[model samples]
Target: MARPGPRPARDHGRRSQPRPAPRPRGRRRRAPHVRERAVPALAHEGEVPSLARRRLSRLSRGVPARLRGPRLLRRALSRDDRRPCARPEAQARLRGRGEGSRLRGAEADEVGLVLGSTQDRHRGGLVSGIRLERTGALVTARFDKARGNAIDEPFTQELLQVAKELGADPGVRGVLLASAHPKLFSPGLDLVTLIEYDRAAMERFMRLFAQAVWALYALPKPVVAAINGHAVAGGCILALTADYRILRRGGVQVGLNEVKVGVPLPWSVALLLRASVPPTALTSVALLGRNFADDEAIAVGLADQLADADGFEDFGRARLEEFADKDTDSIAITKGYLRDAVLREMRARESEEMDAWLERWFSDGTRERIRQIVAGMGKGR
Candidate 1:
């Protein structure tokens, strides 16, 4: 009876449950590479990357392949490219490659932007790198100088001349100040250029700069600054002179950063700021001299509108036209009244202000800082 074979399994009185099979621990799956996750179609098919794909590759270059998941891949393909890369080194590397702030040629017109092609249409090279284009009642003054449209003698003179020309022309109902290059407006004074100037030369240019800014500030027409790029120091002052400012939405900064560089705002410049920014933000904006992105700039009243960089120029033109279509007579008169006090203060204290600015400009500490800044920027004369 008991053949002593295997015991008949001890089933005491309960039914036994079957054990599940163990999961095979194959080599831990490596996260998919960015190319695979971002563009599976192209990756599997083994085709060359297009501009968009190149941008994606660059966006994920330094990131670990494991971290380049589907979420990050989506961001790489979408509007977030307007933001900076996750890695600082990657950003600097991109800049060194002359790509200019993650601007890719995925779209049609952006091809031209990435190619660094000049706008040949309606371009009048009136002042070397500066261009003046007149279309109907709109006059566009574009600064396109070397070194981010540096504020040198020719630049100051061109601005002053353009302001005068627009003020006198009865048919000109609006003016739009712009930059030929989309990503760089102006970096204020040409420190390297100015560092070589003798005292007389420096004073003369500074005086001319004041006159230019005053002329721009006092212009009666609907003046709109279409800033598609970085605008700091003198550039910010130039923007403030406008009745309204439209700045490119992302990856650009605008500020009156004179204090950071050991310079004070000239009287005319200070007046422009006081009128443009709100009283609540005045002290912080003027005294701190901090750079602000598009949203922050609009919030502080430094920038009036935010525009996408893709068609920023056209958008600015349409916006300027909107303002220009208003009642020219009443708008002119009202603007004059609003600006009268600023003009009075400017005229009364121009001499004293110039003297103070010159004194500070030539001070030992300021000069040393200026030299250091120039050296750092590798813009030495």
Candidate 2:
């Protein structure tokens, strides 16, 4: 019927498809040139796209529209308008423009100014037979003698000098005495040296030894002893000079053992023991020459407190700080009043006492006893 619906159309060789609609022309797609240039510039500036976005967010909060772009940021960083940050290397790199652009130089100058004003504040250094360190108002002197920190002629002289220097230093508010040895604060006098000494040598040694202890005892500032190890004989006498003595607990022994070694106690040594040890225990502590452990020492008033070995110095420091508020001049005056009699007695009797000690030391019985003691020490070692 439609029989020839118009014989309408003749067959076409291919079917046609509809075309896509044209994009709106309002903004005209961004040119490829713009995208390519922008991406590479950001890449060259060592900023990742995400980081750049974050920076842009931060900049947008306060930057004017005219200064909001990456071009302005780059220009500002390149010019020396602001500090180049705290990084030294970065500042160094940026300082190539001229010496005036060196930020670190200014910082160094400020630092030098501060250091110059204080000199070597809080500095630490060494002296023979001891190490001295300064921290704030506290100064510490550590005994480091070669022979168990034994009181030898040289050791005594050095210690005496150090004590005098620290006593005279206005900057040092307090002094802490300690031993560098782990097991022996000091084993007393160097017997080997003593055995070799003649009357003159022994006299000189004893005089200086007395002076050394007196220096510490009379020191204007407070002195604290950190007895981290054995303090026997003369070592105990040394500790007794301190305002406070803190003993390390566990296996450490302290006392005047002169009688046990067949050596009679010096007059000064006897006085020190009488002053520090309880009067009731003085006979057993000094006469019997018995050694006491930390607890016993504390019980007998030979030590102020018992501290763990690791914390001895800290304990001593705390003890010193207890007097931090006391006027140093007042303390010196009071201590002088309390100790003047003892010091005077020692000074008055030193010559005669030392002569008698030298005579006893060279006696056949005492010399024989000392030889045995040295032999025993050698065997123990």
TM-score of each: 0.66, 0.66
Task: List, residue by residue over 298-344, the lDDT tens digit for candidate 1.
Answer: 98998988999788888998999898999988879999999999888
lDDT of 2: 0.69
Clashes of 1: 0
What is the Cα-based lDDT of residue 308 in candidate 1? 91
Per-model CA lDDT versus the true structure: 0.72, 0.69
Q: Give lDDT for model 1.
A: 0.72
In candidate 2 the C-alpha lDDT for residue 122 amounts to 30
Error of 2 at 307 (Å): 0.9
lDDT (10s digit) by residue, model 2, range 1-381: 445443333348554555699867553432323323434333322322232233335544544444445563432221211122223334455565665343234443332111100011132211136655444567667786676787787678767877787778786788888887899989999897688888788888888999998888878888889999999888999999998888998978988888876767888877777777779998889788888986788888778888886666778887887775588888888889888888888788877888777777888888998988878878887
- How good is model 2 by TM-score? 0.66
